[model samples]
Target: MESPGRLPYRRLMIYLDRLGYLLGLEGVALLRAFREDGSDRAFVEARIAEIRRLLDTPALAEAGGVTAEPGAVSMAEVYAAWAPHYDAGGNQMIDSEQPVVRSILDGLPVGVALDAACGTGRHTAYLAELGHQVIGIDRSPDMLAHARARLPGASLLEADLHRLPLPDDAVDTVVCALALVHVPDLARALAEFARVLRPGGHLVISDPHLLSAYLAPRKERTSADGRPALVADHHRPLSDYLAAALPLGFQVRRCAEPRRPALPLVAGTRPPESLPPHGAWDIMYWCPEAANAAMENTPVAVVWHFQLS
Candidate 1:
């Protein structure tokens, strides 16, 4: 009795596309009418009820996470509030990036090193452990508070990456990770890093890949009061970094672009393996299908190593 344009098969194909986009099993079970499988509608209903119950439970983080009133906040304020949960959340970058930085720094010389735009001193602490005089710099006082707590002995400063306070030739190495994506003027920041480093010093940077920018990347976190907060990031092509750094006396020595690891499958979704070999399956966002088709084979994060010339 249905019209040909609105036939079940055509409608089902469209639903399948939307269903698999960054959703978990609980989301699939909520739309009870779409259970074409006919295998077990009761199981679907039971799972949805269980999910609802779990959502009703109170979380301790909700009590302490949000502190400000219901209003807009700056990125600095967001990090200030997010410091408590910074390392505890689903940040896939910290895990994927540390190894890359460690691998590049393994055989390189270590002297006075700057953790440019250091957040919470994670890399700063690691650099100090490796026998470098580590100086951590960030613009946020609240973020610096957490960094200071973790690295009392290391010199921590409240400063902006755009204008590093140190004198020229002050350090032998600088590690700027995952922070460049937020900078509007990459050239100025790169110049500042170069200005402080002694000639031949190493500069390592890790940033979100350009594809994420093309797809419009956003950072989401819970405010101190448990409200959703979003931060925007700017993405530039990896080549742009190389171009901006070269004229500033940085000689590119190494580069790595690593894609995210595969994620778990959700209900009613085609197994990831069923997609075309080049189609993306790990990006945890919803981009237009055409964009996915074009970028599925590209990496999602980029790390670069440069030596000051």
Candidate 2:
């Protein structure tokens, strides 16, 4: 049972999380205050200052901790070089998928969480901040390099998603963020995650929606040095994903086809016809004729949350 103010604090947190998104960096201090136990005003204020300081400062990563070994092929090589800049770059996935995933995760039990295919620890860091014991795994050493720096206390492993190193029924939650598209056969990965989750453990997955895949040029990406790399992107329709998982004794709790966020228009770029003229305009169309046409028909990403029966 919670105390007098605890229930109110918890309820306030739900509203505040959404508030944080709309407010950005400025909301951090206010949100930080709510994380306190009523008794600790000084501790909360100090932590807020620390967060503000860390947000502005550049990390001084040591040589060994930051280096990513180059891969033999273009598929691997692209991610290897891009690993350092992956978190720093303008990523639509983080902006679009994360908020939806984070909101779903809010209602789930916080315990041991497996960050399957955790690239650069985006979800890993969030799960930790939510008070979960996080174990982050990825095949890319380059991405793992950044993840290691981001989460020093959490266990970060370099491993294939098809064969997770953890024991069966080990984790309480499994979070696979935007990585399922790369695996052609999700059976192996899904089976492995099921094997590792205790009964009733929750699984949260986010991927580029199959509908958008056919409509957009999102699967392939070029590296920093102009080397073209095309990663394998399997189109698993919603029916296919649900079909595969239901047989594993999992029941769907929630699902979302989250729309792409309306980003601030680039300077000198004309606003799209869809965007209403405003004091501060937001637009989704990079190339209004092409991008907007595809975006209008389908969601940016597919997300799911399920609990094992």
lDDT of each: 0.67, 0.67
lDDT of 1 by residue, 1-309 (tens): 245776442122111122222233344334323544442666556555644543453431122222222223356877777788886856766766778988887767879999998998888888888889899999878878888989886799988889999999999989998898878689999999999999999999999888645432233344556655434445788778978999998998999987655433343333233222111334322222222332333466799999998
Cα lDDT of model 2 by residue, 175-207, tens digit: 999888777578778989899999999999999
TM-score per candidate: 0.66, 0.65
The weakest ten consecutive residues by lDDT in model 2 span 60-69
lDDT of 2: 0.67
lDDT of 1 at 293: 30
